[model samples]
Target: MAGDASPAVAALSEAELLSRIFPRLAVDATHSAATLLGPGDDAAIISAPDARTVISIDTQVQDQDFRLAWPNGYRSTGFDVGWKAAAQNLSDINAMGARATSMVVSLTLPPDTPVTWVEDLADGLTAGIRGLGADGCSVAGGDLGRGREISVTVAVLGTLDGGPPVLRSGAQPGDVLALAGTAGQAAAGLALLESGVPMEQLDDGLRNLTERQRRPVPPLQAGPAARKAGATAMLDVSDGLLRDGRRMALASHVAMDLDPDRLGPLAAGVEPAARLLGRNAMEWVLSGGEDHGLLATFPPDIQLPPGFTAIGSIQALGIDEGPRVTIAGRAADTGGWDHFAD
Candidate 1:
């Protein structure tokens, strides 16, 4: 492989690269308590205190999901990619109402990719895991490979801590719909990035929005809290609220009725950007994707978990009306992120 030294990764043997990068992952001292055994073995051992494991995987590819270059595209840093990658998978585990325990990441990179970039990526991943306040979660192990483009795949493992896993099919009529974190920020940031607005020209708020697009911070704690509070159904809003809400409604055989008044606060954060782009902030709030916030339904009489705000309600699906989601008494646009759609 060293003979094909045209790319940086090829300049050194795989062993050499691993030797240089593992230390940067920081899996040593601040490791998760749930990690019984971490990297350097054939396989890792993680604790499943609940005797059941929750797992989820996600992948990010170069150009398709992000770009390392400028204002014309996603000026994402290695840290941003690592952070977003971890957040995406962690959100999935959270949606199941489990606590993240460990992760195994696989990386496919071009030979020319720098070693420092990989190191920074590891740091970002560590930061993301720790940021969740799950001191028991860690990156157990991973694999590295050579490819034409950069791609990151992470498989996360979590434990329900003896609680039943939350599912989208559990909502029932009269359940209150709630949300635990901000929405529209990621989509608004994406719009700003695609608008050709130079980073230097951006104010602090716009800059923050761009950062959100680069590295989203999902409310990881809300998932388990909602479950503990007896949530009937739940999911992570990786897609737009309307789209995902429709999914939950269909699964639960119910109708989701969103109150625009309840969504106003969520839309306010993006109003400035929406005005600058001549787009509606509410549209972003309802249809934007990648926020990864927890969306849940609970019995109306149950007190909502901390950080969760009531935003909608679940109703029985009428005989004439199939399972659907609505906002302000009207059907909402189902448009959202579709990898295969033109």
Candidate 2:
């Protein structure tokens, strides 16, 4: 309790921690093999005889990565943290064109953390996992230790399900760039909250804006669908689209032009949130992060996969530089989220 910032962070008990945090970290049981051994005894084992296993992990630490006191209650913050961890990890499996079969989480926190906050964290992770229909992934196992701040790490195991994995380098110049899900809502929400605007003052239109900061619902189905539809290249919109799109452009060696008109429709009804904070909704849509949407490029004339809209087009290589982002034929200056740079 030496450096604990909140009273809630200092009141967590062992049983309380077990109930709240443990469930969220358990892996799914239904899809696992009968030969898999876990809990109760010495060590855990699994039989993956049929399909290829793909694994990915992600970790989060307080202050350096998240704030327990920002925007909302500690419970909401825990939920957001858990949801983000699950989304990022699950996206890695989806990127491989695989089905996530299981997940395990390890958490470290200050001993004084409240039991309720831990439970909320687990609930958030569960909500996110359910959204993906990742039935097999459960909170399988983890270890906890005393720490100065909360730290969470999740490892996800997936089955390729007999398909080829999509990669960032697969895009070509003739492909059409498409996206599913809104961009920048989280950033706008952060702005609103930061500017001292109360959530009650805003209408329902902006709820999604704030929610984006808490729980990012990734388009899990889109990756496999695009692969099935013969997408030439693909990526998840974890970072801002412009930044990630620039990544795609550089990786594939092409220029990208985005139609703001097309993007405008994708971000409909968020102006009130913008107005509340004296910010531009369009700027949020263009530059926000953590939406966890899907971004992909496909053949120009082919029918697009379901649930996606045409947002832009892949361009031929330019003589000027790497990954130019243009809006309505004019160059856009913003392209990324630089954590350390202003």
lDDT of every predicted structure (CA atoms): 0.87, 0.72
In angstroms, the error of model 1 at 181 is 0.9
The true-versus-predicted C-alpha distance at residue 164 of model 1, in Å, is 0.8
lDDT of 1 at 271: 94
- Residues 80-189 of candidate 1 have per-residue lDDT tens digits of 88988989999999999998989999999888887667777888898888776655788889999999989999999999999999999999999999998888999998
lDDT of 2 at 40: 36
lDDT of 2 by residue, 216-242 (tens): 777777777877887887777766888
In model 1, the worst 10-residue window by lDDT is: 1-10
Candidate 1 Cα outliers beyond 4 Å, as residue runs: 1-7, 27-30, 70-74
Estimate TM-scores for all models: 0.95, 0.86
